[model samples]
Target: MTENPGFLLTVLAFVLVIGPLVFVHELGHYIAGRIFGVKAETFSIGFGGTIAGWHDKRGTHWKLGWLPLGGYVRFAGDMGAASQPTAEWLALPPEERAKTFQAKPLWQRSIIVAAGAIVNFLFAILILGSFAYLEGVPRTPPVIAMVAEGSAADRAGMKEGDRILSISGRSIGDFEDIYRIVRFSPIEPMQIAIDRGGNRLSVDVTPGVLVERDRFGNEYRMGQLGIGKPPAVYDDIGLLEAPLVGAERTWGIVRLMVDTLGQVVTGRRSVKELGGPLKIAQVSGEAAMMGWESLIGFIALVSINLGFINLLPVPMLDGGHLFFYAIEAIRRKPVPVEAQEWAYRGGFALLVSLMLLVTFNDLTSFGLWQKLGGLIG
Candidate 1:
């Protein structure tokens, strides 16, 4: 496809990636609501004007809309994100509001909110594990897969299949460990210990810095060695074992995110790494071009991210709702309605502001404004 069409295709691809994750997320809420006997008025994807939908026997309106950004599951008496505690809620004759979310027990509310995120995570894990079993899990053996022509490793006479035992003085357990060291300390010259056919060799190779795009269109400067595997061996496992593997992989990514954020907080990692929808769109398009496997892998990662982010203790999010539930559980009463309203407003503002900033970053990263300026000039 032409580049212009590619952009459109990319948009569709992103929707594909995002839509299913969101559906799975909202499905969790839907399921939980049904289980708890909470009334659900609408189950909609996208927001705003409903383009198409249907009414189920249970009176739930399942619809799709023109906008494709995100979706929501509206429970009975949502009162919107910034729900008010009007006399109507209190004067609901008790029995009526009992079916509403606001009237649910603290534990039930927590479960309903927490379910969405949990489902996203579960979906990611299952996808990952299935891929692992199908593809025989690619593993790097702490060995050099290839050396870029005329690159540092080539200059140092590094050969393929040379097992990397150590970098500087630190031991290397896996090829990934070496990658982490190189990316984290790109500029530093390091000593390497290699194992070649039962022979030990030592050399020094300075990793070169290069810009790489992650699955989410975010660009990062990291050490590049210009090497990768053709296809590594995978530890075979049965169907029953795949799901656990997937869950473990999902957890690994979660741990990496936590670690990266910790590093960012400590000023060791850059905030520029933070990406938004634009980045996701760019990456989604790129992944589509790469192949189905790559796209699926990217989707899984994004799904995991969505799950983890929603679990954050920010207002208007599943985690944030759960936070209030926790307080209710502890205090034996809900936090004041005024406090919840203000908290949601603040959270919504923060979310919108962050989106704007990330979009700006995306525009800059893509040189969109620069190209436009050149056209004007």
Candidate 2:
């Protein structure tokens, strides 16, 4: 309720964060449909009972809903934006059927379905690129300032004044990259290339366990190389080069996310790291508290995440729709309607299961169960 400050902040942050992303995604679909000559019937920002709405010049019902969880856009002949043709859709006169989504050619349909995710990725690129243009690219050179005595770096023959060039074959852009990699990889040893004066040498270092405390008085274990970087410096970024730098930055996140998913599939990563709405809301609230710049950066990261996740070729996703289109293209005809229904059903179930898992993970992250146990014990 609104009386509970923390609770209200979380809810508000969740709505604020999810609202724009979903609006942008649906806008992509809506715009693409208009470009391709499909009539959009309704553009709603949420589900269930409508709170406020009006008809537009284009004969589209634009409305806000009471539920703030998710949103959709329904075209003239779409059962929904998923664009599956239904019996009602089929019952339309031949003249009316011309405006239906299924009437569009395969290529157009594919583009429309994929537009939401593509726009999300583009949003991230623009956000990051703009930051780069204004603030410049971080070029900290990864030089070590001091190595903790008898710590992981010291034990691995690392010395002070060493300039790190790369880790595990990946070039280190900044000191933060080193921290992220080290923190994520606990068991793996890092093969690092360094520049010592004029000599280029390599070293292998296993990260040591470092217990840390957060503002919440919560304890966490992160990997420690026991090495610190020198003062920060940034590269001179031009307006033209800013977007390219941003794309490169976005690509890095995409690669990391993909690799993380691969690790999960291979059982090398814990599924508990998966975050749903609750985790997102918490992060959003934290970012909001931090300041506007932090919140903007968080939004950019989430946009990239939304794009990447939607592009995964899973059922009940944008990628899933595209997957069926690919099959249809190859088969020279649509997959049977019965088969599609079954596939969508399966996809919905998969999504629901993932939602439940991530919600449980969020609860655990919040220490809800632990607090309850403490109460009971």
Structural similarity to truth (TM-score) of each candidate = 0.79, 0.88
- Tens digits of per-residue lDDT, candidate 1, 1-377, equal 22332678789899989889889999999999889988899998888898999999989999998888789999887675644455667778677688887777768877888999999989998899898788765465887778789877888889899999998777776676677667755545789999999999999887777887654445568876666644555567789988987997798678667766776777766666677888898788888887899899999999999999999999978888888878878898778888988999999998898788878877888789899999999
The prediction achieving the highest lDDT against the true structure is 2
Model 2 stretches astray by more than 4 angstroms: 1-5, 80-84, 90-95, 161-163, 173-176, 194-204, 217-221, 374-377
Q: Largest TM-score belongs to which candidate? A: 2
In model 1, the runs with Cα more than 4 Å from the true position are: 1-5, 80-85, 91-95, 138-208, 212-219, 223-231, 375-377
| Candidate 1 overall lDDT versus native | 0.81
- In model 1, what is the error at residue 253, expressed in angstroms? 1.0
lDDT for residue 11 in candidate 1, whole number 0-100: 95
